[model samples]
Target: MVTGGFVVDLNKPLVSQVGHLGEAYEEWVHRPIVTKESPRFFASDVLEFLTLTVWWAVPLIWLPVVCWFVSTAVQMGFPSRQVAVTMVCGIFVWTLLEYSLHRFLFHIKTKTYWGNTMHYLLHGCHHKHPMDGLRLVFPPAATLILLMAFWSLVKLLTPPSVARAFVGGGLLGYIMYDCTHYYLHHGKPTKGISSNLKRSHMNHHFRIQDKGFGITSSFWDKVFGTLPPTNPAEKSR
Candidate 1:
């Protein structure tokens, strides 16, 4: 009964209240959307897929480039292992953010003033649109501001090389998170880890809806006690 493109809960039976779109729209926001066999991504929907691709890839790759520049500056013409280590560390840091942010920010039902506003602006907007195409990834302006803040923190506490490396790693984690999220929601895999992730994410969208917030991994869900129950409210989608 969805109309004007809205997210629907698949776990629940279709009711008149749920308008426009169906469960699939909300569940797989990043995929080439189609309820009844739209064109394949490369063939018919190439333009849409390409836009989403560049949306996530640019920032993910840009972090490393920025890091390289910062690292060189911080090195002061010196070669050391710190730069390498920072790069490695930086990437891992992103994974943490992926797990944490997805769990805490995206899934939570904000109850407070600021929390609710932030939720709506950030994750809620996605839930609402889910397929606007341009809104899938974080805005570049927002990304730049975040990076600037991180860079300032790095400069204050760590060497430029180390900071850049750490930031680079974080960017990778974000890239993985964004790309993997998009794939899980849309691009179906033949099988393997990607498939597994897809299933987990699907469950999050269609089955539980309120739990299994972790996208890349469920490590934090368990830690934070947000993991879905074995027998979740079945009418969840």
Candidate 2:
């Protein structure tokens, strides 16, 4: 079915329909379509709008949840030092999670109908339309679901107070990540780390999708040996 000028067949795998869209699967997925608005995902306007989010909404929605987590840990009699340390550890854990999810799940190849449809809805849409400002960040509806799952996992593995602190830190890390991701797509950072990060992410979107999966930093890409080639000539090939 066509929605917002993009074709999607719910009964057939998206990969199989690429030729009909007039591009090879790889080329169509990697070639960015510049647009100010996001494409429709649901027939219902309300449901479709729920999938599109502005970059600013990330902090506005999650900041209070982070504060609540940290404060609850403090109220549970965890020492300030312990709470602080656990929170930092949580942030560190988020970095690794970010890298792994991007490389493994978001970029996973699938040919089944549901697999391709879900993949397109989740991440492929962003790759196919890299500059769609409305879709640059994760929508709160999707994020809340993942946050609940991770919260349960953290709480299960750690003491109550520690879990709260850690989750708070991880949530902060996510906030930074989403904001950084949106900025990388739209902000002009001519120098320093921001510039480097923007270049790395742009390469991931336009040049090499399999490499440079780390959105917030390239540190993990370096650790995993997935960093994209630095030479412009090599990238162009």
Q: How far off is residue 19 in model 1, in Å?
A: 18
Q: For model 1, how does the per-residue alpha-carbon lDDT over 1-237 read when each residue is reduced to its tens digit?
A: 233365445434322222233333333333323232222222335433442334565556575665575466466643556656666676566666666667666766544445544554466545544444455566555566766776687679876555666676666566566666666656769798777667766666545666677777767768877666656444543
Clashing pairs in 2: none
lDDT of each: 0.56, 0.83
What tens digits encode model 2's per-residue C-alpha lDDT throughout 128-196? 878889888889988998899999999899999999999999999999999999999999999999999
- Which stretches of candidate 2 lie above 4 Å from their native place? 1-26, 235-237
Worst 10 residues of 2 by lDDT: 18-27
Q: Model 1: residues >4 Å from true position, as ranges?
A: 1-82, 111-118, 222-237
TM for every model, in the order presented, reads 0.63, 0.88
After TM-score superposition, the amount by which residue 81's alpha carbon in candidate 1 deviates from its true location, in angstroms, is: 5.4
Per model, state how many residue pairs clash: 12, 0
